[model samples]
Target: MEMTKKIAIIGAGPGGLAAGMLLSQLGYEVNIYEKNDRIGGRTALHKMGKYSFDIGPSALTMTHVLTSLFMDCKRDILDYVSLLPINPIHTLYFQEVTFPLYSDYAATKAVIKTYFPGEEEGFDRFMKENTKKMLYISPLNQFNYSSLFDFFRPTTLRAIPSLTLGRSLMDDLARYFNSKYLRLAFSLQMRYLGMSPWDIPAAYSIVPFSEFYYGTFHPIGGQNKIVEAMQQVVTENKGKFFFNSEVTDFELEGNEIKGARLASGQVIEADYYFTNLDFMYSLGNKPNNHLEKKEYSSSAFMLYLGLSIVLPLSHQSIVFPDNYREFSDNTIHKKILSKDLAIHITNPSATDNTMAPINHSSIRIMVSVPNNTSAIDWDKETKEFRQLILDTVKERLDFPDLDDYIEEEYIITPKDWEEKYHVKYGAVFGLQHLTRQHGFLHPSKKLPKYKNLFVIGAGALSGSSLPFIIENAQITTRKFLQKENPSNQ
Candidate 1:
């Protein structure tokens, strides 16, 4: 008779939750430990009176990732979570002009012809080329790289030229879009990776293309609902979730992790451990002393507002600064906080009535900023930044008295992300996905010296996108399963 393997998972983030469900269904005794009082670390919901706001990932693209997970369990995604379509994906507002991008190819082309005239041909070529690039790159993301040379395989070798190896995301966009603002519009999707278009590799050009191809979505309740659905799946599969249970350190035997020490002075032992924490934060007295030398993604200064009155805005909108390139370089490279800022706002009340009370709005605003490595002091700058954000919103978004209807408000700074959430340096998206960081080069390496130890999350393969994180969890799970049963390998 075969004995069940005991699996210990740290952190209750999306990846952790998904891994729990997947492993539990396969007959493993899974236990997920979360530091917070609830599930969904960054994807958690914050309630302010009658308003419900998502702490992270307001929009959902690549629905098939979630669908595939549910289908694997012989269940339907819709039965677990209701996903609502977001038409005209998002409204992009520039200093001088504004336009909405549609998922419909013809409709989007029409908008391009109207706003960015003479660039329709560029849009066509971009879609055609990126579709091919996605076909090549998507499969690579699904692989579990055991070594750096795995990237040199035929599949990766064939993708070398299309990978935009030496070029930046902005460079790739410039090849298609003539207008700088249109390019900025396309490149803003890089923010999801917590990277600047000028720095992240051109292969990420697939971001905007995926948004246009697969479209975007929102859960009926909030982004948190997806995690709630996953939680239910895990629970039904006999997985146990321990809330407010924090893992302080791991007891190591040679290279294998023996047990996880919790904050309450209790140690939990398991045959296999899957740490879902940020990779940088999980390291202990390793070669890297302070982790100061490592490259991290940009952090965010977020504002969650519950307003008594709703704003006449789309479900999702972004306000780009006057000079996007300079703004990007200053914030991401020089670590300078400029007056010209790019603000991403999500008003979920417009699409889902459950987000707020009748006629009210639950708005989440995210501003990309340098991680904690910068000398910027959030304790002193938060109030000023809040004012700047509100002022900019009122002016650019055409809301003269946007502050009048605020019934409640919350602000999360980079400092808060570090102290409260334990994200290393408050880099919410974990490590930056630079060109060299792809495949086995990523810090979220699958094969660690400790054979029983594994990692899954934004800190893992690819980057911080929700779909990639889920796919990474799936791939990591597959690798682990195959190792346990050599026949599967």
Candidate 2:
């Protein structure tokens, strides 16, 4: 009788769940240990009264990547979850003016013409170049990162001219559009990765290309349904999941990770270990020896509100300040909240009734803030900052008597995220996606100290984003399987 290999996964995020499903399908006995009672790390949904808030990520793009994983594992994602396309993908509110960006290229072009008529030719050129860039960059995102120099190889070097790392996103947008409104609308997507357009590489504009091309979507029930579906897939594949089990430390023997010790003192061993938690957390007491510590991207302060009456806003709205640069720069050193900050509001109730009551609505207000874990006092700062955010949202959106309609409200500060998810400095995405730290420069999935240890999540290859995280899981699992069973291949 032959024994099957045993695998243990840390964290129940999308990356961990996807890797468990894949390895289980390959006849490996897999177990996932999650500190929280529920799966889906950042993708988890919180229910307050009748409102269901998507705790972290709001938009769902790159469905193909997810569906492909299901298909490869001989399962149908549609069977477990339903996804609906969101038209006009998102409504951009720039400098008090609003513009709708559609999934249809012709319609989007028409809207662009209306906003920046004189720049039509340049807009056309920009779209053509973006399409070309996406073709080259998207594949690189699906591959594993062994080293920074790998991207400079002959094959990757040929695509260097298309990467546009030489210029910033703002610099590239300025080359095409004369209207600051259009520039802000396009450049603001960089904020999704917690980067200012002036510092983010122009290649990141490929983000919009993928969204507009594939069309933005939301799961029919809520973002949480995606997690439920992944959970189902993992279970059906005979994988075990242990919730509320926190990992305290790794039990390493020689060059191999023997098992993980839970805070409760239980030990589970495996042949391979994949950690989906932030790479920094995996370092434990050895923070200095870990990847050179760099400042993480800005953490967000979110307010979820349940209203008695539905607001006339669309699914998504971005209210930018008069000076985008001021808001961007303030995040650098300031621990205090700003009145003229950028606000992103989303009404998931517009698409999913399950999120709110029949006649009511659910809204999430978000503002990026500095992770001031050291200087600012959270107890004093959270209260003052919450009031400031509420006042700013009302002033920008013209919603009167907001406190009156609020049936239920909850706020999540950076401090809350750090306490809940164990992310270092409460950084939403693992590392900041800057020019020098991106691509092969990001942490390698293969650890230097341990032979059987690997990483799969936002902190690993492909940067962040839901689709890319799942891709990292699939790619990492494939490499491990190949390494273990060369004869099978």
Candidate 3:
């Protein structure tokens, strides 16, 4: 038998835990170092009094990705964590009407045609086209995207129609809808990537396709339970986890990584290192050079409210601005603060019993904003931004007495996320999905100067979604395992 290779993964985010769990099962000695006391980096949970909320990634789309990962480990996923389906996936509140999008193909089309009318054909065409686009591009998402040239491989070019190069997600969706409201519905997936549809690559239309195809989900306890389940898997496989251990820097011998040095002055050696941190944070003092030159994604202003009273609301709702284009341009491109803005509301307690007190609810409000790349003074501005969000939500969403019902409230500005999570430029989703930043144009997953180091997670390969993060971990683990084999070596 070959000797086991010791591995050290920085950050216990979903990516790190997934890799640690899988690789540990393969008989590697895996150790995960997490800066925070809890696991699940960004998707971790928060508790205030009797109310509980998922700090990030409240919605879980493409849950099959997780199902497959757990099953591949020879464990039934449902046994570890329970996932509840999010039907009528999201309710969209436009100026004139409220639209509910369902997961069923027939139901979604019917809703679109009923509201927009004379638009069934385009809706079908979009489903057909983006369905094909999703199938064609999905396998590529798992490819060890080392460089741009690898993206031009013959397998990808055949899926050319799905590329729709040089066009934006908004432009491509325009072909599918005459209704600005309907177009907004389909193109709104761009916001999840922290980019505007007007600038994000048309290839990203896969966001909506994935949502409709696989449907949206929420775990029983909270979305953070997904991370908790992954951590359980790691422990079952004998993987070790070190919490409250912040990695100060890498210990390198020549070009290869020897191990990582912790803030506690402990040095643990490993044969290989995986960074679950965002790409920029992983680089530390290393010259970012081309890495910094890439466009970073936008940030978010968030409010986590623990309500004394449960409101009759869906698991998720989107309130769109009367003019979405102007809103997108202001938040994404111009980086201007919009007093009147689009916001996402998530009420997890509406469905789950474990998230809050009896007859109470937990709500999260998120509004996209320019990342730290701008000159905005978040410390001073966030104080006012909180009031703007509270006022807007109460007015537009008809929660006039929200302030009185609030039992506990937690606000996170972009600066708060940056200072807390070590996110580069406070870009939660990492790189922008522009022509250069999307698809094969995504920056290299491996550091150009480091041979044994790998990057995985939102800021690295597989974009920002939770499923994609798990996929990135799987791909990175397999590649490393393959290289470990004598034949590949």
Candidate 4:
């Protein structure tokens, strides 16, 4: 009889759930310790009265990555979550003009040609080149790179040409077309990762390409259903869960972790340990490893509106500010709280009836503000900022009398994420994808000091997007599995 390998995971985030499902299927006795009474971490649902909203990641992209997770467990994708395609994937409200980006390639190309006229050729060329680029590097993001030497391995070497050197993601788009609106539609994907489009590496052009190529999807109930589904997979395979159990610290001897100490003073012993906690919150705290040198991703100011009526709009929309260059610069770099803010609105109820009351809207707004480090006072300014966003949405989009229709409202600022979510400085996107901070430069999935330790979530291997974070779990779990087998013979 063989002994079952016992593994303990510290968070119940999508990354943690992903790891638990995979490891349990591989026959590991797993226990996940989540601080909250509920699962899903940021992926969890937010409810105010009868209104339900997705607190994080309002848009679902790269859905094939999620389908692959269920397939790995030999389960039907539809068995866990039902997905509905969003036709006009996103309608861009760029100042005065309205652009509807369709899911169909021919339709989107037609829209681009209609608006910008001469730029359809550029869109066609981009679709051709970027499709090849994504094909080359998509496989590379799924592996762990322990060092620069590891980066030069076969997969990374093969992806070198697609790496997009000597320019930012914004500059790369400029090479394709002259329309800033078109450039913006493509570039918005990477910025949501808390990086400025002009600052992040050009390789992330894959964000929009993947979304347009694969099309966008919404779970029948909510994105949170995916979290619930993963939990089912974990327990069915014999994995255990401990909710509301906060990990206070770890018991370590030199480079190896022996056990994890909970807040109640009970320590859980395991053969191998993995934490789904945020990169900074897990480490550097009294109970976890912490590095002072690591910089964090930017935070957000979010509003979830439970309205009496739905707006006449697409499923998703972005309302760009008039001065986007200055807005992007100040929001990220100069650390100014601009009254002119770029707002993203997602009306989940428009597509999924379960998210809100009959015909009522569940609106999620994300305004990319600074992390908590700024001198500006959030406590005093939250009201004004909220009003500014609401005013802009109502006035600019001509959604008349929006103030009259609000039935309930919920808001989360950077301070809430820092204090409640316990992320490092409330970084919404985890680590910033700067030239000095991305790729092999970010934290490794396997910590250098601890032999039986691993990590997952926003800050790991791939960037923090849901699909990419799941890929991080796949990579981390594969390493442990390979180590267990050692050789096929």
Candidate 5:
């Protein structure tokens, strides 16, 4: 009789949870070990009194990814979670004007004509060109490429033009928009990766394009609903979750992971090991201080505020600094916090009443800051920086008595990410998506020497965002099936 395969997953983040669902459905015995008592690492939920906030990922785009995952499992996603579409995806507040990005092509064009007349033509061209770019690149994003030879595949070869070699995101936007503010509006999506528009490659222009093409969504309760839904699927398939059971390190043989060692000194052996821990954190030791050489993405300082009054704001909003480029350079390159801040505020109460009590609001604020590599002392800086963000919001949004309404509050700085969450360098976005880190060049899902070990998370090939990470997990699962059941092929 053939023995059933057992897979051990470390960390119950989105990636691990998704992997558990996929693998369990494939008839594998799956066990997930998480350090925290709750699931959903960074994607976890936080509740204070009657208000709640999604700890990360304020909004959800790319609904099709979740739809496909559920379809593959022979289940309907709606049965587990409710998805509400967000119109006017997000509102952008400039110094002199407010602009809302809509999924409707005609509506977006009308807004462009109203705000900056001549730019309406540019919007049409931008959509047309970027649609082609997304078509060219989408196919290859689903592959699990571990080496440069993988790029030699016909699919990757066909994507070269869409890569837009040697062009930055700012340069690509400039090709269409003559207005600097308009360019800034489109490139605001760069914050999702913790990158500067002048630094990330033009191929990423597909990001903003995708937002307008496929409108964003909000899960009725919070972004964490996706996690809870996936967990339900995993549990229904007989997957087990071990909370507060941390996998401290892996016991290794010549070229395989023998077993995972937990913090309690327990050794759990399995047929395969999948870790969703932060990439660098999984390495156990940096080995010659190699970590000092790699470039990491910037970190975020987040504030979760539960207010006593309803906030008169859209579901999502971005308030740009007076000078975006300077602020980007300071926060991402110079490794310093800029007083001129670009803040993203999400008031989920606008669309989902479940987020807060009646007549109350739950607000989440995120500001980019230097990662843990910077010497800035978050202990000394968090108080003043928090006040600065609140003050800026009060002044810019004309909410004079904003402070008086804060009934409950929580903050996460780069320091808190490292000490509490164990994220390497407190880089919430993982590695920087530089030109050198694209496609085959990014960290491979499987290490060359580790025959039975794999990685799936923000640091892997698909990079950041909940959808990409979950998709990458699916790819990893398929690859695992092919390798272990070659005869079944």
Candidate 6:
């Protein structure tokens, strides 16, 4: 009798967990090792005195990506987690006016009309064009391509009229509407990928379509509930999860990954290994020359606040300064926190009461800052920076004595994230989603020197979104299984 193959997955983030679950479902014996005590790398929730906040990825878009994962397992995602649609997905606050982006096209258009009355036709045209762009790029997202050149082939060329990476997202919108407020509202979605609209490829315009078309969703309990659901699937498939087990080194035999050595001085061997840890970090303490040559993504500074009083703001809000470009430049070049920055405020308790104490609220304020490696004095700077942000939020939103409402607060500077998550440079997203580093040019599952080793998550193809990471995991597992067992195919 042929023995069942064993697979070891490193990291318990969504990608690693999803990969382990799928492989186990395919009848392989899988073991998942997570360095952290909990699952969900960046998606984990941090609890304070009376508030629970989603430490990473505050919003959920592209529900179909998640649903497809459940469908593949011959189950429904809804059975695992309840998803609630959030209409007017988020409110964009600018110096001039505030606009709500609704799931319904008509409703969003009407909101736009309220501010720019005569520009309804323009808004409609822009949406139509944006939708066309999404339809064109959708195929690339769902399937694997051989190379960057392949995207310019005849079939892809046919869609070129709809695809536009030649211009920035801001420039594309500038062609449609002259209002800075409207422009800011639409372009703020670029920040979802930690990019600036002024430099981000227009091809990314599809981001808004994903949210508007599929609608933004929130898990009923907390973001961590999704992690629990993924874990359940893995457990149901007979996969073993080893939390708080840090992988210290890879046991290689003749350029093939034989197993891994844990920080606890134990060894776990497997036929194949899948790593969801940050690509750079997974290369072991002393990396080979090639691994060291690769680049990394931008880091972030996040502040999780548990308010003593309920905040009157919406579930999601982006407070933009007059000079959004300066903020973007500061993040990209200076690696400094912008004085007039873009702030993403989320009060999950508004949508799910379990997040905070009765009549209280939970809020998180995120600002793109330099990676931890930068020479900024976070120890000395954190207090001053937090105060600046608080002052700015109070003035912009006109909250009455907002400082008094803080019952408990926790801040994750880039240094904290780097030390905790092993994310090189404290980058939340594994790699930058630039034109050169996107799609096919992104890292591949097949390791350069190791035959049985593979990579998954934001560092690999499909880029750094929850849905894409999950998708990449599924794709990598399927490919590996097919390669290892031709009879199964």
The candidate scoring highest on lDDT is 5
TM-score winner between 2 and 5, please give it: 5
lDDT of 4 by residue, 83-192 (tens): 98887888888776999998799999999988999999998888888999998888877656656787778887888888887688899999898998999888885346
Residue 383 displacement (Å), model 2: 2.5
Q: Per-residue CA lDDT of candidate 1, range 238-326, in tens?
A: 99999888888788888888888888999999999888745325546355533355578889999999988879889989999887777
lDDT of 6: 0.78
Name every residue pair that clashes in candidate 3: none
How would you encode candidate 2's per-residue C-alpha lDDT over 1-489 as one tens digit per residue? 999888889889999988988888888999999999999988998889777889878888889988998998898888988888777777876655788888787888888888767777776777889888877776675455566667766657766888886898899988888888878777765347876677778888878777777888889768889988988988998899998998888877777778788889998898889886454355545555345566567778888898999887878888887788878767644545566878888888777788898989889988887764446566778877877777876777777767889999988878887886777776676567776566555555334557788788877754588888888888888778778878977
Model 6 ranges with Cα > 4 A deviation: 142-155, 277-297, 443-447, 487-489
TM-score of 6: 0.93
lDDT of each candidate versus the true structure? 0.85, 0.78, 0.82, 0.82, 0.86, 0.78
Winner by TM-score between candidate 6 and candidate 4: 4
Best-to-worst TM-score order: 5, 1, 4, 3, 2, 6
Q: Give TM-scores for every candidate, taking all chains together and pairing residue i with residue i.
A: 0.97, 0.95, 0.95, 0.96, 0.97, 0.93
Better of 1 and 2 by TM-score: 1
Writing each residue's lDDT as its tens digit, candidate 6 over 4-78 gives 989989888898988977888889999999888888888887888778988888778888888888888787998
Give per-residue CA lDDT, model 3, range 1-489, as digits (tens).
768888888889988988888888888898998888999888999999998988888788888899989987888889988888887788999878998998898999889878988998998888889888888888776676456776688767776777888888889988988988888888876457888888888888888888888888888989888888899988988899999998888777788877688889998888888885453345555775777788877899889999888787888888888787787778777887887788998998767888998888888989998888888998889878888887887787787678889899998888987898888888888877666555455666435456678777776663788888889889888778777774864
User: 373 in model 2: Cα distance from truth in Å?
Assistant: 5.3
Deviation from native of the Cα of residue 240 in model 3, angstroms: 0.7
Model 1 ranges with Cα > 4 A deviation: 277-284, 446-448
In TM-score terms, candidate 4 sits at 0.96
Between candidates 3 and 5, which one is better according to TM-score? 5
